[model samples]
Target: MLRSCCFRCFGRRNGDGLLWHMDLKPHASGDFSIAVVQANSSLEDQSQVFTSPSATYVGVYDGHGGPEASRFVNRHLFPYLHKFSKEQGGLSPDVIKKAFNATEEDFTRLVKRSMPVKPQIASVGSCCLVGAISDGELYVANLGDSRAVLGRRGFDGEKSLVAERLSTDHNVSCENVRKEVEALHPDDSHIVVYCRGVWRIKGIIQVSRSIGDVYLKKPEFHRDPVFQQYGNFVPMKRPVLTAEPSIVTRKLIPQDLFLIFASDGLWEHLSDEAAVQIVSKYPRAGIAKRLVAAALQEAAKKREVRYKDIKKIERGIRRHFHDDITVVVIYLDHHKSSSKPNHKQGTAGCITPPVDIFSYNSDEAVENSGDKIFPNEESRSRVAY
Candidate 1:
């Protein structure tokens, strides 16, 4: 049923640019919508949604410096989650943490291995945010500033939904985050610095926790000749950024209407309440795309430009107005029967965008040139959704 539904409904691209969206699709607990708009020259943001009869996993990775780190996470994180969940017999906070750490370590090793040929991998990193639902329980794990927000009804018989943030932001812009970083390195007065009107760790990166950014985390990488070419390299006695995620777990109830998982691109322009209220008042179909449009509209308004004009600008130039945005809106359906198994039994069917959206414009083209476009078998299969 899930496969037939996906084949019939089909994911579609919007306009001529880098935007892609899936109107609506069924997951274990309910329905979900996904949308992504690329702004960077190479599309640094990567996202995926995996659904099955008993579980659903959502990931949004917002990359910086390069797309390699985010793409690596996209390729490795979920499998690691699945591997650990299977070995441990179930998903838990420890399982999720292990997945994150495993992915981070693997990426670090990749950077090390590729340094001889592609030394820039050391500078690439991404913010990872994951929302996983299993057996009526919800788990939110996050590193960096990407967010997951829960929309639920009020406790006193109220009809309106309340916005509750489920993940912690690790960006140094927050006072608490800066203090945490400073407290970790008391002797380094410049551990967190105010530069270019924003707080950054070592005046280099805003996120204090992430999967990569190996140059900031490894002293050996910091001393590498390749990293030194970036200018103003700050020496650190220890790793400044961490792969550890701030994890939160909760039991899903009927009152939990839906969840909005998005990158900082959407949050920078739209507030949590605004995003949740839009989903609450709008149609389920294309709600994720609608939220992205709302954020883009706000981004346009801030610059005194029309939304149409903003859409006209090419990828790299568009980054000046807004970063790459990825949104997944998961609606809870407590009344739905969970006993029915999915088409592949309990295995999740994955839905993900191509590594580079700018390269492919249509579903037909992507399907026709799957091997040329995706290159890797795992990548090709992942985008089949």
Candidate 2:
């Protein structure tokens, strides 16, 4: 039987300025949890949680160039999502897409207003990952390289569990992604290049899809003061980047156990199987924090430092070892839900909540302009665990 529960059981916790956590709560599988750790000089990651008797929403946002873009999305995206859901009378792909479009358009307008004063704003961008569970369905959507992995049981056997990825990564390091960029701009032979063993677009950004980075999406931002640092190229052309998202929808079943939603930072030190293994073997409460701790321990191993020692390192300096990492583990409850396989769900969930998402597999040598790829992370797509 698929266990379901009302979203009201959420609990929240904060770690240092660089770390924060949310313990288990009512979720599609059972209980849900989340955690975030800052490794950047300034926290470039943002996250959100919304739960009710009927639905739950999770987001992880990884900002690059600056925190402005992520903060903006954190403050605005959820409201837009709620608005679209209400207008459409329920959550659907159209509503989710509209929510993303609204957020992208809003951020673009903000850039048009600020770029004259802050040229670098045009360069700021964020990878967004969102997961929404309503009724008996689960919806996962992404822009950039963030990832979502599902853990399930009763597959190989009742006691055996596995990890299944649920999102598409837009990082150019993937040959398919590189081919995609080339196909999108067949005229540009140098659209994607291999540098430092990493693949990048236009020899700069690694992500081909994102919420901001107006400098890439608009020719207007390609010239002068704003994008001067982005380097000069031919004049007048179509966009160099896109904000559209890749989406996946599925019916939640009894075998589905939990999900691990995280930023590229975590992927740097962990694998889908490893992550699912950890989750399957541990307790549900604070599972997200446990994942972060596991990743940090792995990061320390690369530097040959003790995990305790690594935890003592401060933010700005710590970034040398790891990127900003954020994780949310949603433990689905198939045991408590009063609903059956065909039963209707309750009407719950509020429109007000913080929404942020970022996940990637960076174990590969990746190349993106401006941002240096530290040898600590990797990125990937969604697959059924």
RMSD, one per candidate, in order: 4.8, 9.8
lDDT of 1 at 300: 94
Among all candidates shown, the one with the greatest lDDT:
1
What local distance difference test score does each model get?
A: 0.84, 0.74
Could you tell me the lDDT of residue 28 within candidate 2? 34
lDDT measured at residue 382 in model 2 versus the true structure, 0 to 100? 29
Clashing pairs in 1: none
Residue 197 lDDT in model 1? 92
Q: Report the number of the highest-TM-score candidate.
A: 1
Cα lDDT tens digits, model 1, 212-240, are: 99988888887888767753466788999
